[model samples]
Structure formats: C-alpha cells, structure tokens
Target: MTMINEPAHTLPVLGEYDVAVAGGGPAGFAAAISAAREGAKTVIIEQTGMIGGIATAGLMSHWAGSAASSVLQELYKRSTVPDIVEKFPWQGTINPEKLKFVMFEMLHEANVHVLLYTFVSGAVKEGTTLKGLIIENKSGRQAVLAKTVIDATGDGDAAARAGAEFVKGREGDGKMQPVTIMFKVAGVDYSRAVFPGGFEANLDVPKGKIQDLSRQALPFPAGHTLLYPSSLPGIVTVNMTNFIGIDGTNADDLAKAEYECRKQMDPIVKFLRDTVPGFEQCFIISTASLLGVRETRHFVGEYTLNEDDILASRVFDDWVVLRAKFNFDIHNIDGPGLDKNGAQKHFPNVDGYSIPYRSLLPKTVDGLILAGRCISGTHKAHSNYRVMPICAAMGEAAGIAASIAAKEKIAPRKVGVKKIQDVLIARGVKP
Candidate 1:
C-alpha cells in the first residue's frame, strides 16, 4: 500500500437533520420513512441514482417472505404486478421498476429529504458518538450533521468509519461467502419450462448433476444456479454463477470479482439456451449493475445474536423488529456449500424470531444505530436475518428509535425499548 499527502481543505457543511440515514437500500428507505412519519427532520443519503438497493440495482426481483410487517405489506400491495400478492407467505416476484417508483412515492408522502448520488466517505465522531458525516458526490465533498445516525449501508460502512468494532466473514479464516452477479434473459417460453415448485426450483438441481453439467458446458466451476420468472412474460432472472474467494470489502478483490463474474455470464447463458427446456430462445438481457455480496462487515453491538439463538428461536424482552420465517441460510465459504442443498435451516414450529433492540445499538458507539444485514449478529444468525424483508423491519425499528432519541435529546442507547415497541406494534410489526 502507498500513501499520498494532499493539502487540507475545509468541507462545506450541509444542513443538519434530526436523523440521518446512511444508505438508500431497503433498510435506509424504511428508516427514513419511519423517522419522517414520526415528525423527525430526516434525511436519507444514497450513492445511486435511485433508492431500493439490491432489489432494484442488484436485480433481485423476488421478496422471499409474505406481509410480515406493515411497511413490507404496503410495498407488496403497491407493486405494479398483481401476481406477486397471489404468491403470499411463499415468495413474491416483484417488478424492480415498480419498486423504485413505490419507494419514491412513500418517501415523498412522508416528507423525508433524499440525497441521491451521494456517498458517505467518512464520519466525524467525538469519541463513540458520531457528530457528523463526510459525503462525496459530483458536487465534491461536504458534511451533514445529525443528532443520531442510522447505519443502513448493509456493509456497516458508517459504523466502521466511526471506529466501531466489527468482524467480517466466517470465524476461522475470515473467508466470506462468494458473490454472484444476477442476469436477466428474455424470450423464455414459460409454458414449456418445468418449474415444479416454482421458479426457484431450478436451484434444487442435484449437486452431482450441476457439476456434471458445468463440466460439459464449460470449464467454469460448478456452483449453484437459479432461475426465476420475471414480472414480464418471456423473461427470466438468473441467480447462477458464483465467484468464490473474493473479499467484497477490498477494492481490488471486488474489481476482480466483477470482471470474472461477467466473463462467466456468457457460458451460463449458452448453457441455458442449449439445454434448458424453455430458455432455448432466451438471450442475455442485462446483468446486475452491482455484484450480489452475501456477507461483508458485521458490527459488534450490545448483544451478538448467534447460531444458538436462531436455532432456539429466541425472543427478546426489548424486541424492536421482526424477521421473515426462514432458516439459518449460511452459504459455503469455499464453493457451493449450501447453494446446492439450499442454505435453509427451517424452524417449522415457529413463525419468526424477534431481534433485540440492543443488537442494533453498537456496543461502543453512542448516537448511532445499525440496521440491515450489518447489524450485530454471528455468521449463522446473520444468514437467517439478512434478507430484504427482515432488513426493512430492522430499519423501521431503528428509525423509530432514532426519532425518539432526537426528540428527547438523548443518545440512541438511552431510548426506551418500550417506546419503540409500542410504536412498532402500532405500525403493524408483530410482537
């Protein structure tokens, strides 16, 4: 590594807000809207042109669970495609474009300020409390002051920059789950396609068969491949192709992963066109603008949710959010670990578990809270709660807590759990 010195210059200070959200993804969106609706002067900063992070930009067109929370339920209802609602409780395939529109509308109605095409480059902190954030955009560097900050970046970017203790990847070697680039193909014949259980059925193919097919098609490593029908007819989204041993947080590794994933796309499309029943005429429409990163940075919070908590379906006294009814889905760090078998650890008897408010409060950071997949949790626990629906729920809880903290002029950690719980329950979050 090398370093270069540049002349120091003061950055322009942007307006202050009661609550500042650092990401525009599912968690950020929910946090901003929830805060604003609670009468807090909130601002949501996004690096992209539009909101809806992975769902819109990453091209993940499916919502894995049903209407668990009011905010999620509203998003499902506003989806342009009606069929998504029909699938309820199972899996809902959404129209990404529609989702972007719906999010914008919701934010507008809540009167939340939005800053698009802006990235949080650093944070200004006084000890454990974040006083402001440094942002960079086309307009150059600037700063935004806030009473409380919500880290919904999905990577704990703000928390990490604020000097919060964090961990990345699995326990032993710090190896993370492989990243995938989703692609869409058009000209599929849905009628001829054999989707026994649904579109995700493509992922259920046997591992041996997947390996055999990958070898026959090309030299690319055999991993998991999944295809799901899109909102539009004659089109399908592919969740195949995995780039192993790539560190998502490293710039060099991310660049390499992107290049390698893109190179593997052609062969995958060809494999589908030649062998698949309905994709004979299908061609690559577009690949995701961003790589689908499974795990990156997990912040250390007041309490770390672990594998035992998930398996036992633990309930917290200071419950602040809800997660979808799913399993501990830890993807293999090396190759196609759980992708072949589907990374699901089912809790058949339970609906879902409650995430304690303490998990969102960083252990050492005062005036800051974490949301999305980056919240305090062990690798196994994160696998279950990292999905979009659950992330949104966590964001909603963080927003409510942040707003209350701002109103009372107290640190986020001092906000009462009972206050947050009452508001969440009223907002349609189940206890």
Candidate 2:
C-alpha cells in the first residue's frame, strides 16, 4: 500500500462542559439526562438529526429484551406509549418514535444541551487522558472540552480515535455478525399471519418452514431472512437478509454493503406479497435511514465480560446496568450461506445479568468512560449487551459517573463505582 502524507491543520478549542457525550442513541440519551439531572453542564453531540440512533433511525420494531427483569422494565415504566395503548389491553411493545420522543423529553427536562447534526471526528489527548474532542458539522470543525468524556458512539469511535485499546470483528481473522437493512411493510393481514406466542414466537418462526416454502422466494442480501410485527397495525418490519463478508469499519466496504442491501429489497417485498399469506398486498414503505451495523470496534476496559458471565447471569459489586436475554446472535462469518436453522439456536440463561462499571472504564484511558455495546466486554458478551435497552442503563451510569468526576475534579476512572451506583439508584435506575 502506498501512503500519502498530508499536513495536519491546527484548530482552536471551542467551549467546555462538565460532561460531553458523543452519540445520541439510547446510551447517549440516558447519559446526558442522568448527568444533567445531577446538575452537570452536559452536552450531547450527534450526527443524526434525531436523538435515537438505531431505534429511531433504523426503525427497529421492538427492542430485543425480556419483558421481565431488565432495564426494559424501566423503559416501560417511563414510556407514555403504554398509557396511550393501555386501553387496548396489549402488553409489551414500544413505538420507536414515541420512545425517541420520550428520550428527548427527558433530556430537555433535565436541561442537557443537544448538538445534533454534528459528528465527532477526532480527539485531543494529553498522555492517556482525553482533553477534548473535535467535531464537524455544517458550520465547521470545532473542539469541545469536557472534564469527563463518555464514548457511547456504539462503535467506540471516540475511544478508538483517542488511542484507546480496542478490537474489531471477532477472533480468528476478526469476522463479525451480518448486517441488515430493516424496512417496514404495510397492509399485512392480522388474521392470516401466524402470531404464535406473540413477539418471541413470531420472531422464532420455524426456519424449516421458511426454507421449505415452494412459493416465490424473497431475494435477500445473500443471507437469512426473517420478519416480525412492528408497532403499527397490519405492519411488519423486516430484519430479513444479511450482508455477509463485509467489514463494518471500512467506509468502502460499508458503502458497498448498504448498496447491496438496498438492491435485495424489492424482490423481498415481491416475495412477501406473492407467497406470504398475510402480506399479499403488503408494499415496501421505507428502508432504514442508516445501515444497521451489528458489531464494530470494541474498547478494551478494566474488566472484560465474557460468555461465562452471560451464562452464569453474573452479578458484580460495581454493577451499573442491567441486561436481558438477547443471545449470542453470531451469524456464520465463514462466508454467506443459507442460515436455514439460525433462529432456532437460543441462549439459555438462568436470569438477567448485571453489567459492571469496570467494563465501561477503559483500562488505559484516565478521563474517558465508555457505554453502549462498545464497553469493555468479550466478543461473546457484546452480543448480549449490544442491544438498545441495556445500553440506556450503561449510559445512565456513565453520565452520572462523569458528573461526579466533574464535581470532584477527578478523572472518570478514579470515581468510586459505589457512589455512581447510589446516584443511579436515586435517579430511579436499578443498578
């Protein structure tokens, strides 16, 4: 490979805050809200126009978490959608848009500063500590200083750019799970479609039936295809198909995957309309605003969680967040092939698990804390904690921790986990 040298340009530092959160996803939202609630001058910088990253932008139907014993329970308790749909007697389903609004309301009420349409490009580091971050937008590139920084970019973009130790893809050549482009189809028939046992059963439709279908097949991005109900009536969101053998961190590869995924969409809609009993008149509405990335850079933290922790349903003394059963949804990385038996594999757990604060604190970085899927955890454990609801809890903890650090004028890692947990408990978060 040939390298070209480009001169680096010097930039001026902008404003400072007690805490600066990069990314406005579930974790980022929670972090900013919690930090502001603790009286910290907090700022959230997001590239997307909306606050909810994947849940809103990708229009993910229902969050993948157990209805009982998890952070999702807290979400339900705080959500207004339940109140709106309470008369229907239906249980457990969050409207992505409503949830996004709820997060926005919380952040607004907490007085957190929001900077949407801004992307974090790089960071200013001194020794091992992050002094500030460089962000770019319509205006120009500017630096935002903060006493404490939390990386909830979901891809560990901030930490990875700041010389933090990280891992990408999986072990043994670093292959990762497949990426999907989720879209919604309207005009589905409620009566004809099999509702099995509700969301879980609807999701776990027998792959044998899917594979053995003699009808017209849905063209997918060279992998497994599956569809389940969204929040709206007579609508289903498709998580079908997979973009295989693509590295998510590479811009060129990611762009190709997105293009390939889009090309596979129409035939999928056609197949569903032709073959699926309920989707005869179903039409393709819209694809996700952003490409759905399953895995990305994993920051190395003080404690790396593993599959053992997931299976054991481990509890930590410094536990700061709660997680429900999602599973080790590792798509075959060897290359694309028919995953006729993919959804059948389940992650058996005794109960929900606790995410330790140590997992969020990088082992090397002194001033930065991590939240969301990028937290210090093994590749296997990442599969479980990578979802939205759990990330919110992690964000809440990181935010409060950052606020405490700012107040005490200490580095984020140096803050006591017990104190953070206490703040979380006070803020109605179950640590």
Candidate 3:
C-alpha cells in the first residue's frame, strides 16, 4: 500500500453538545433519544438519509432478544400495525417504513439534533478519550465537539478510528460472519405458508445434508430462503441470500455483497413460486436499500463476555441488559449454513442472559460508551447479544450512563451501575 500526503487544515466546528452519538440505527436511535430525555443536549449523526439503520435500512425488521424498553415500547405503539408480531414466529416484528418515521418523530420529540447523510470521517481524540467526531456531509468536513461520545456506529467505526483496542472476525482466522441482503415478497398465501422456524426453501438440498439439517429442524439447504413476514398482509421478508466471507467494514467487499445479493433475488423468488406451496404467487416487491452485515469490530471493553456466560445465563452485579435472549446464530465464514452450537456447546434451555454495563465501557478509552454488536464479547458471544432488541436495550443504558457522566463530570465507567439501573427500573424496563 502507498500513501499520499495532504496539507493539514482545521475543520469548522459543526456544533457542541453534552453527548454526541455516532450512527442513527436502532441503538443510536435509543441512545440519542434517551440521552436527550435525560436532560442532555445530544446530537446524532447518521450515514444514511433515514434514522433507523439496519432495522429500517437493511430491511431486517424482526425484533428478537430481550423485552422492549420504554423507547421500543413507544416505537411499537406508534407503528402502523402495533400488533404485527401477534402471530409472527419471531419475538417481534416492525413495519420498516413506519419504523423510520416513528424514530424521526421520537427523535424530534426528544429534541435531538439530527444529522443525516453524514459519515464519521474520523474520531476526534484527546489521548485515550474521544473529544468528539469529525463528520463529512454535503456541507463539507466539520467537527462535532461533545463532553461524552457514544459509539453506536455498529461497525465500531468511530472507536476504531480513535485507536480503541478491538477485535475483528474470529480470533485466529479473522473470518467474520456472512452478510445478508433482506428482500420482501408480495402475494403470499399465509394460510399455506410453511414457516419452519423462519424458512422457506427450494428442492435442491443433497439427501445426506438434508437429513443432517432435519435433525436440528433447520431448513434444508438453509441460509437460502428464510422467510420473515411483514406487518402488512401478503408481504413477507426473505432473510436468505448469504454472502460468506465478506467483511462488512470493507468497502470493496460490501459493494460486491450488495450486487451479488441483489442478483440472488430473482432466483430466490423463482424458487419460492416454483417450489413452495404458499409462495406460488409471490413476487419480488422490493429489496432493501442496504445489506445486513452481521458481525464487525468488537471493541475490547472492561469485561469481555463469553459463551459460558451466555450459556449459563449469568447475571452480573453491574447488569445493564436484563434477561437478554438469543441463540448463537453464527453463519459459517468458511462455508455455508448457520452454526448454532453444533460446532460448539449447545445451550440447554431457552433461559435468557444478562449483559453487564462493564461490557459497554471500552477498556482503553474514556469519555466514550460502546453499544450494539460492537460492545465487548467474543465472536461466539457476539452472535448471542447482537440482535435488535438487546442492541436497543444496550443503547438505552449507554445514553443514560453517558448523560449522567457528562452532567456529573465523570467518565462513563464512573457513572455507577446503580444509578443506571434505577433509571431503567423507573422507566418500566421489566427484569
């Protein structure tokens, strides 16, 4: 690799605030809105035109893992069909279109300064502490100064740029999970639709592999045509079309994944119509504007969680997320198919686990909070707590902690778990 040197220049300050949140996804949404509600002047910068990141942009509207927080409750209440998940197999579902607007309305109500179509160019750092973020948008490159920073950028973009110690992919191989392109199909016959635990498929699996997959009740030739229904009738979500070995944070890999995933749509829809019973009339209604990248930079934090903690459903003294639940839904980075404890140890029951606040505090950085999939955890553990609901819950905690730290003139780690827990309990977040 070669480098080119450019003259250094000072950037104009975009604004100053108590808390500056990078990324406006589910986690960022909760983080920014919750921070504002905590009496902190907060600003949230998003890379896309909309606020809801993967949930809305990636079109993966299914909400699994843990109970809904107050923010999620309000979001679901204002949705077009609040009870969309009444019959859905998943824990919850959302109308992605309506979800976007609800987040916008909620952010506005919380008085969070929203910056859309903005990218975090770099992290503004003061030693190990992040002072703010350097953002680039239509206006041009600028700086956002803040007392505290929340790294909800999903990929840990801001934190990584700030020299935070983090891990990428598996420890040895550096192979991360595959990227998915979620699409929607219309004219589905729900009564005849066979949702074998979130999947529909074509008649193309090898006999021996089919038997192996059937033992686990996993869709044969799985990771090909999984179906998650939408709130509106006749429209169903397709969670298949996996591109293995694609690094989400890599630009070249992402571009390739998007193109390849989109190209799989025609075949996938055809497979549904030609093979599946209820999807005989199904057609491609729309494809997501973004690709759903599962795993990325996992910033090493105060306490790195592991599979044993999740498997044993361990609770911590500084628990931030109360009773989080999700399987180790790890996609094969070296091959195809989902790896859910088959290669590792299977969780014995459906018991939920707790995530500590310590996991959200980056070990080497001050004045910064970690949220979403990027928080401290091993590759296997990341697969467990990387779901939407848990991410939102983590974001909620991050916001409250960040605000308290900013107001009290302390680092996020010093905000104390008791203070954050009290706030969460008062907000009706049931354990």
Candidate 4:
C-alpha cells in the first residue's frame, strides 16, 4: 500500500437539512418521501442521474414480495407502481422506465430535495455521532449537514465511511453473491416458450454444462439463468450471467465485473436463440447501465436477523416491516450458479415475517439509521430483505424514525420504537 499527504482544504456546505439520505434506490426513495411527508427538511443524494438503483439503472425490472404484505399491499391497493406489464397474472413485473418517473414524482410531491449525480465519498462525525455527509459531484466537493442521517445506500456507504462497524460477504472465504448484468431480448414467441407461471423461469435448454456448485441434496440444478417477461410483448429481461469472485465494494473488482458481465451478453443470446423455443428469433437489445450487485456491506446493528427467523415467520414487538413475504434467497458466493434454496417458493404462512427496527440501528453509531439490504442481517437474511418491495418498507420505517428524531432533536437510535410502530400501523401496516 502507498500513502500520500493531501493538503487540507475547505469544503462549501451544500445545505443543512433535517434529514439527508444517501443512495436514491428504492429504499432511499421511500425514506426521502416518507421523511419529507412527515415535515422534515430532507434531501436525498444519488450517485447516478436516475433514481431507482437496481430496478431502473441495473435494468432488473422485476418486483419481489407478495401483495398480501405491508407497504407493498398498499402499493398494490393504490396501484402506485402500476402493473403496466405482467409476465403472468400476478408476477409483479414492472416497467423500469415508468418506475423511475413514478419515484421522482412522489419525492417531488413530498417537497423533498433531490441531488443527482453526486457521490457520498465520506462523512463528518463527532465522537460516535454522524453529523453530515461529504459528497463529490461535478460542482466540486461539499458537505450536507443534517440532524438525522439514513444509510439507504444499499452498500452501507455512509455508515461505513462514518466508521460504523460492518462486515462484508459471508464468513470464512468472505465471498459475496455473484453480480449480473441484466439484458433484454426481443422477438420471443410467448406460445413457444416454457412460460412458467411466475415471473421467473429456469429454462432447461439454456443450461450449460452443469457442475456441482452446491454439492448438497440439490446437486446444483440445470440453467444458471432466470428470465422474466418485459412490459412489452415478445421481450424478456434475462438475468443469466453470473460474474463470480468479484467484490462489489472494490473499484477494481466492480470494473472487472462490468466488463465481464457485458461480455456474457452476446453468447447468452446466441445460446437462447440456438436452442430455446421462443427465443429462436430473439436478439440482444440493451444491457443494464449498472451491474446488479446483490451483496455488499452489511452493517452491524443492535440485533442481527437470521435464516431461522425468516423460516419461522417471526414477528417482533418492535417490528417496523410487517408480513415481509420474500423468501430467504442467496446466490452461490463462489460460483456462477443459483442457490437452489433461493426464493423459498412454498412457505406455509401467508402472514409472512417482520423486519425488526433494532436491525436498522447501527450498534456503534448515533444519528444513523440502516435500510435496504445492508441492514443488520446474516447473508441469507440479507438476500431475503434485499428485494425492491421489502427494501421500500424498511426505508419508509427509517424515514419515519428519522423525521421523528429530527423533530424531537434526538438521535435516531434514541427514538421510541413504539412511536415508529404506531406510525406504520396508522399507515395501514398492522405492526
């Protein structure tokens, strides 16, 4: 490693806000909108020009979680993100382009400030308290002061930069989930394709030479691919390529993944066209602007979620997210294969499980709230909560908690969990 001295320089304060959110993904969008609606002077910063991180930017247009659950059920009731397209009658697929605008309009209606094309490179901290965020953009380096900060960055960027305790990947080899470059293909024949009832289907024809990625009872099933119907007829979004052995948090590894995953596009299209029934005339259309990096930094919080909690359909008294029905899904950390246990399709309980508020509070940091996949949870649990629908619920809770903390002039961790719970219940969640 090499070290160099950089001269001290003053940074302009961008603006002071009651609540500031980093990463304008699903979690950030919900967090900012909820906070602003609660009368907090909130501002959300996103690294890209567009909001909706994985859903829009990453081109992963599929929505997870059932309509029988909390905020998601309300969204379903209100038709918030319209079922513009459906692979099946109830697959929950969406049009990403439309979703980006929908999220933006919601934030605008809430009067929340949005700063696009900005990166949160660092943070301002006093003792163990996160005071503000250090951001960089075309304008130059600056600061955004805030009373309550929410780390909806998905990668725990703000919390990690503020010296919050965190861990990356799973134990042992410390390998995270594989990254994919989602691409769309056209000229598919609906009648000819296997057309699995759900949005996701693993076509046996596209299976390359299979290996025992997981040598357990599964023996690693064929087809490391997942295809979902696009909003348009004869078009499908393919999440097939898996660039394993790359770290999402490392710049060099991410760069390599972007290059490698893009390279998988043409060959995969050819494979589908050459063998699959519906994709015989299909051709590659577009690759995602961003790689779909599933797992990254998981921040240590007051209580960690685990696989058993999800399996038992557990609920907590201090629960924030209710009836989170997404399965305990995880990709193979060291191989280009799907975790057979991914998306527990046949869970008995329709009531689902709850995500505890304690999991959103970073154990070692004050004035900070966690949301999205990076919240305190095991790798498997993180996979379940990482989906867009569930992430939005967690973000809403974080937003409500943050706004209350800002109004009361208290740290986010010090806010009464019951108050947050009551707000969620009033909003139609039974927590």
Candidate 5:
C-alpha cells in the first residue's frame, strides 16, 4: 500500500448533535430513536438512502432470535401483513418495504435527525476522545460534531478510525463467515409446495439432487439452498449463495463478492424452477442492494464477551441490555458445507444472557459507544448477538447511555450503568 499527499483545505461543519450515530441499520435506528426520546439532540448518518440496513437494502426479510425489545415488537406490530402471529408464530417474517416505512415513521415521531446517503469517512479525535466525524456526501466532505458518538456501523468503522483497537474474523488465518446475497422469487406455487414445516424443512427433496446442483451450478459455498416465505403471497426469498473467503471491509473484496454472488443467482434460480416443485413457475424478482457480511471487525471494548459468558447465561452487574434465547450459529467460513448441519452450538435450556454496558465502550476511546455487531465480543459470541433483534436491544442501551453522558457532560464510559438499565426497563426493555 502507498500513501498520497494532498493539499490541505478547510471543510464545512454540519450541525452539532448531543448524540451522533453512524449506520442506519436496526441498531442505528434504535439508537437514534432511543436517544431522541430521551430528549437528546440525536442525528443518524447512514451511507444508504434507507434506514433499515440489511432488512430493507439487503432483502433479509426474516427476523431471527426472540423479538424481546419493545422497539422490535413495535416494528412487528406495524407490519402490513395481518395474522403475523399465525403465519410466523415464533420468529416473524418481515415485509422489508413495510419495515422501512415503519422505521421512518418511528424516527420521525421521535424527531431524530437522519442524514441518508451520507458516509462517515473517519473520526476526528483529540487524544482518546472523539471530537467530531468526517463525513462525505453529495455536498462533499464536512464535519459533524457530537458530545457522544455511537459506532453502530457493524464493522466498527467509527471506533476503528478513532484509533480504537479491534479484531477481525476468527483466529489463525483470520477467515470470516461468507457473505451472501438474498434474492426474491415470485409466482411460487404454495398449493403445490411440499414444504412440511417450511422450505428449510423440505428435507425429502433428496440429498443427491442438492449435491448435484451444487457441483453443476455456479460457485456457491452453501451445499444446500434455503428459502423462506415472504409476507407477500406466492413469493419467497432465497438464501442460497455464499461467497467464501472474502473480507467485507475491503472495497475490492466486497466488489468482487457482489459481482460473483449476482452471477451465481441465475443458475440457482434455474435449478430451483426446473428441479424444485413449488418454484416451477417462479422468476427472480430482485436481489439485495447490499452484500450480507456475516462477520467483520469487532471492537476491543472495556469488556470482551466470550463463549463462556454466553454459555453460562451470565448476568452482568453492569447490565444494560439482554439478548434473547439464541445459539452460536457460525456459518462456514470457507468453501461448501454451509448447510443447516454446519458448525453450530445450541443453548437449548438457557433463557437469555445479559450484555454488560462495558461491552459497548471501546477500551481506549472516550465519549464513544458501540452498538450492534461491532460491540466487544469474541467471534463465537458475536454470532449470537449479531442478529437484528439483539442488535436493536444493544442500540437502545447505547442510545440511552449516550443520552445520559451528553446530559451530564461526561464520558460515555462514565455514564451510570444502572441509569441506563432503569431507562430501558421503563421503556419496556428487559434489563
């Protein structure tokens, strides 16, 4: 790598905020809403035009883990699909468009300033404290000052740029879980569909057929194709392609991954229509706008959540958030073997685990907090907390913590954990 020198120039300053959140995914959305509801002048900067990140842009139309947070429950209630309870009795399916609108409505109701199509290039820091953020948009480069900053970028972008220590992928060769591109197919024949429990449960479709398809189709890491019924009738979303050994944070790798994943879609779609019964008349509707990066940078926070914490269902004294019943579900890091039978560790008896407030505070960054998958955790633990529901819960906690810090003119790490927990409890979140 080489560096290029450029002439210095003055940059415009955007409006100051009490709490500034980077990323507009489930975590960022919840953080902005929670902070604003707490009377903090909050602003959310999202690179994409829409607020719901993976759910809307990535076409991940399913909600995993228990929807325990009030924010998630509210979004589910606003869903356009009636009888959601009956259709998805356990973890509900989402209509992405409906979710986008609901997120916009909630953010507006809370009066949270949202800057879409804006990218946070880097952080402006003085010693260990982050002073402002360098943002690039259509108007060009500018700065946005905030009393408290939340790194919810999912890749620890803000924290990493602020000189906070972090880790990427698993140990050894640093291999990460594969990136995926989800697509929707319309005109599915539900009446003729032979899915017993659902598409995932259609195991009678012969293993030889899937193995043959995997060998003949475009390079797909997942040994088997998986589909889920969407909120729309006669429509199903496919999660069949996985691009292995690609580092999502690298621009070149992401570009290649996106291209290769799209290339794989046509063959998979053809195979589904020709071989699968229900998809005989199906056609590809649309693919995700963004690549689904399963694992990436995990910031080194005040506390790093480990496998033991998750397995023992540890309750932290500085509890600020909770993750509902879920297991360590690590997808295959490389090559094929990404079926449901891939590497997984289930906690069938455990109810849930508490995520300490310390995990959201970067070890060396002051006035900075983290939300979502970027929070401090080992690779295995990150798998469980990286889902939408858990990320939303973490965001809500980070937002409240940021609000308290801004109000008291204190560092985010110094904000009282009990205060945050209390606010969350009042807002119908389990501490």
Candidate 6:
C-alpha cells in the first residue's frame, strides 16, 4: 500500500456551505439532503464514487430496520425517487442501485454540492471548533471550509482526530464482533431457496449437522448460514460465516482474514452446489470492496444509550429516531468464543426504543457530530442502533442540528435540542 502524507494547505475559498458532510454513506447522504432541503448550503464529500455507503459498497443486502418515523422516514420523503411503502416488519431489503439513484437525485434536487473521491484526512480546528477539513484527492491535499461538520465515517475518524474520547471493540478487552465478507450470488432459484426447510431454511444447521457436514467436507458456517434475496431476481446475497477475530483497523489482520475467507469460500460454494437445490450454477458475484466492519470506535457522546433502554422501549424528550428491534441477532467474533457460544442469548424485546440526538454529539469534541455505528451507546444498544436505517436517521438529525447551529453562528453543543426537534417534526421526521 502506498501511503502518502500530503501537507494541508488552504485552498482558494472553494465556496462555503452551511454544513459539510464527510462520508457519503447512508448517514452522510441523509445529512447532506436534509441540510440542503432545509435551505442550508450543504456540501457532501465522499471518498468513493458512489453515494450509498454500506448499502451500495458493502452490498449489505437488506436494511435491517423499519422505515417508519425518525430520520429514516425523512430520508424517503426527501428522496427524488418513488416513496417507500411500509411493507416491512424487519429485515427489509432494498434495491441498491435504485437506492443509489434515489440518493443522487435527492442531493441534486436539494442543490447540495457533492464532492466524490475526496478523502478527509484531518480537521482544520479553531480552538474547540473545526473551521474546515483537509481533504486528499487526485489533485492533492486541499481544505474545505464549512460552518459545521458531520463525522459519518462510521469509524468516527473526525471525532477521534479532533481529540474526542471513544471506545473500540468490547469494553476493557479489545475483542470486537466478527467482520463478514458480504458477497452476492446470482443464478439462484428464489422459489427453491425460500421453500419450507429449503437451503435458506436449513441455514441454522444443527451442531449434529455441522459435525456431519464437517466430516462430509461441506461448505457452511459452524452452525448457521444467513442468506437473503438480492435486489435482482435469481440472485441472493450471502453474509454467511465470518472472518473471526479480525481487527478492521489493522491492515495486516484484515489482509489475512480476506485471504483466509476467500480460500474458505471454495468448499462452501461446492457444498451448496452439490447438497442444496437450485444452486448448481450459483457463483460469487462480488465481495465487498471494503470489509463489512460491524463495530469500531464508539465515540463517547453526550448520552450513552444502554441495552436496557432499548428493551424498556425508552423514549426520550430529545429523541431523534426510533428503532423497531433490539439487538436480536448479535454476533461477536472475539473473546471467550462468543460467536460459537452466545448465539442463544437473545435480548427480550418485541419492540424497539428511541435514540437521542445527544448520542451523536461527542462529549469531548466541539463543532463535530457523529452518525452511524460510531455514536455513543452501550455495546448491546450499538448492536441494534448500528444498523444502516438508524444511522441514516441520526444523520438527518445531525445535519439539521449542524445547520441550525451554523445559521445562528453558535457552537453545535450550544444549539437547543428543542429547536432541533421542532425542525425534525416540521419535516415529518418523528423526533
């Protein structure tokens, strides 16, 4: 890997904006659109060509939550494409390409300036506030001056670099959840795949079966295989197995995991072809360009939502978004064999809870807001809220709040939560 250290220099006032959102994933997309739609000069800087982050790049296969109230709903309303119908209880799938176009059109219609292939390397800080960002691109390093910035990098890169406090992996121990190499398989027989007790049904092959399969040299996870329909018919996305104990931030660790996982996929594919029905010609379409990192640095924000709060369906006066499920299928790749042993420890929850905007505001950082999985929350709570839908919801709130703060020429932390809530409510975003 070629790592270049380009010195940060002031670029000719590359225009100003009310808000500058970094990381054009679900959160950044929502933030940029929300800010621009709310009549703020917004600019989105994405490191990649695409707008949808995990949804497009990671090929996440499906959105793991409902698109009802909260920031999630606001996104659908703000989009330029067709509105999403409430047709889900959980584990909802979306067309990545359609969603991408929708996001692109939304930003365009909102008049938000988008800068793709721009990597935000550092922040240009003034005391506690970041006046702009130092971006590295094909043209070299330059500055993007803005009033407020949102750290939707998912890894909390902005907050961390700005000297914010954060916790990575599990508390105390450095163990983290496994990172899945998500891939899509085409030429699948959807009818046969979704059949009762079919390939998808036998996903959670029992230990007896696992042992039997292991002896028979079949390709499968130790106990279960999670697969879902892709946006295209005759295609299915597979998030099965895991690259255990791989640290996403560590290049070497990720490299090894990728190699091992690719090697391991061969047998699994062979097994599916021979043992499973309607998968004889199934093949790996594409692996995620980047690793699907589940957990990383969780920024310590103004509020730390806990698992109990989610279970109790706790609603806060400062709530910015709502969740529909607790951490149901939580997985950890490291520590005490959690992935192998903790599968049965499901949190009791028939409903989800509200997430406060405070969770997005890092306690130790000023003029910087975080969205996505990096927001403040307990481990268990992160499991539920870390999904894409909630992250996008939080992104909307953060964008609106930042814009409000910018317009008032005040610090983000000084912005009133009530004002933010008012704007969200007016926009039909359940706050």
C-alpha lDDT values of all predictions: 0.79, 0.74, 0.81, 0.79, 0.81, 0.71
Question: How well is each residue in 1-431 modelled by candidate 2, as lDDT tens digits?
Answer: 99999788877766789999999987888788878878999999998988888878877766666412223455566663554321222334556677777767777887888888999999989898998799998879889999988998888889988889988867556767778788888888866764322212323233345433412254533434466665567777777646777777788988898888888887777766655677889888777887888888888888998888878888888888754566665555543332322332455774888888899999887789998888988767787778777787788788889999999999888899899877766656554
- Model 1 ranges with Cα > 4 A deviation: 83-91, 195-219, 337-342, 345-350
> Candidate 5 at residue 62, lDDT?
80
lDDT tens string, model 6, 1-431? 88999685446556677888989998898888877867889889888788888887777776766533444554444432322432221335656666777778778888999888888888878887777787888877787878888989888777777788988867677677777677777777766663221122333232334324433563333223456665466777766546667777677987886776676666666755665566778898777776677888888889998877877989888887765453434574532113432322344676768888889888876888888788998766777787777788788888888889888999888889888888877877553
Give me the runs in candidate 4 sitting further than 4 Å from their true place.
67-88, 196-223, 340-343, 346-350
For residues 319-406, what per-residue lDDT tens digits would candidate 5 score against the true structure?
Answer: 8777555667677675654335233333453578888989998998898999999999988888888888889889888899999998
Residues 1-431 of candidate 4 have per-residue lDDT tens digits of: 99999898999999999999999998898888888878999999999988888978988756777422344453443333434343444436767776678777777788999999999999999999999999999999999999989998889999999999988988555678888888888889977775432213333444432122112212122135466776577888887767888788899999998887777677777766765668889998787888889999888899999878887888888888877877666776656454665555554455678888999999998989998889999888887888888898899999999999988999987899999888877777754
TM-score ranking of the models: 5, 1, 3, 4, 2, 6
Alpha carbon lDDT at 93, candidate 5: 83
Angstrom error of the Cα, residue 352, model 1: value is 1.3
Task: Spell out the clash pairs found in candidate 6.
Answer: 178-333, 219-268
> What CA RMSD would you report for each candidate?
3.0, 3.5, 3.6, 3.8, 2.6, 4.3
- Candidate 5's displacement at residue 181, Å, is 0.7
Q: Where is the poorest 10-residue window by lDDT in model 2?
A: 195-204
The clash number for model 5 is: 0
> What lDDT does candidate 2 reach at residue 70?
27
Instruction: Report the Cα lDDT for candidate 2.
Output: 0.74
Model 3 regions more than 4 Å off:
80-91, 198-223, 340-347
Model 2 residue runs over 4 Å out of place are: 1-10, 66-92, 195-208, 214-216, 220-223, 334-345, 429-431
Error of 4 at 379 (Å): 1.2
